[model samples]
Target: MACIQVVIWLFVVQCSAVCFANYVLKEEPEYKHTLLKRILMEENFESLESKINNLTQRVEALEKENALLKHAPVAFLAELTKSVTSQNQIILFDSVKLNLGNAYFNVHGNFIAPVSGLYQFSVTACAATNHYIVLELIVNARVVGKVLTGDTGYNECSSNSFLVQLSTGDDVYVQHKTAGDYLLANPAAGFPTFSGVLLNVI
Candidate 1:
């Protein structure tokens, strides 16, 4: 009877050991699967972060380009072809040497401001022999500067330069201030010329 009891106890112990081993084997794959899922999630998060950083860099580059385009160059130069002698007449400088930004119109002899800014303008008026001329630089019908070539025995020229604040669409031109016999437009004496440039953007 004692020998039978010992055999039964051994069998029970062996069965318990085998059941524990099986449980351990079944849990190992689940643990490995959970670890792999966590690693993949981490990799996806890193990829998303990299894409966000790249998009931010592209946006910054585009903003810098837009700022550069806003501050482009603006300037012009014009000269008269025919003499102007009448008082209060707008001198038609029909010859355009340079019209940067297309702001200067040779047809009506006007430089309309394309953007608001501080500007520098110059006008050179030439008077024929025995004749005098008074020229005015006008901004929107208001005189900002004036030049006078007094009646001298020989042909003479006078010039005036001024700095003025201008708004967008302001009209700028040279006009006859006082009547005279002739304003020298002859190539020999030198033609009347008007020129302007944007100094700084407002």
Candidate 2:
């Protein structure tokens, strides 16, 4: 009888041990899967953060470029009209004063250096008489060089171009020669008589 009892007890203990082991194995598998899911989530968050930083940097760069484009190359235009006694001359368009007889315009303006790169200048003039329109690139009230439009006649146009390295705070203007009765006219609207020059910076 005792032997029988001992065998039954041993069987019961073995079964109990098997049940506990199965439970432990099942629980361990679920914990390992949970840990793997957490690791993947962290990796995904890191990737998203990197993308946001890159996009922010690109956006800042574009904004700066747009600002630069808006502030480059100032332009001005002048028109000529008829007058009663003296033919209207658009003298002194900007920083430059026009002397019709001398055929030169004196230029003066504040020069704010745009960048540390090469710069180009262009000027165009239209008149009603046969004369040469000369363009002088002046730096700080001094003439660096001069370009002549060769031949220009009445109702004709002339232009000149120049390239120079400019630093910040440089001033420039155009001077022209005046002949006959030439007078500076207001560029405002409804003046009847008009004559002037156009200045462009690039």
The candidate that achieves the highest TM-score relative to the unseen native structure: 1
Question: Which one wins on lDDT?
Answer: 1
Span of 10 residues, lowest total lDDT, candidate 2: 190-199
Q: How well is each residue in 163-188 modelled by candidate 1, as lDDT tens digits?
A: 99999999999888555657778654
Q: Write model 2 residue lDDT over 79-99, tens digit each, in one string.
A: 333221233222344423332
Write down the lDDT that model 2 would get. Answer: 0.46
TM-score of 1: 0.64
User: Model 2, residue 106: displacement in angstroms?
Assistant: 13
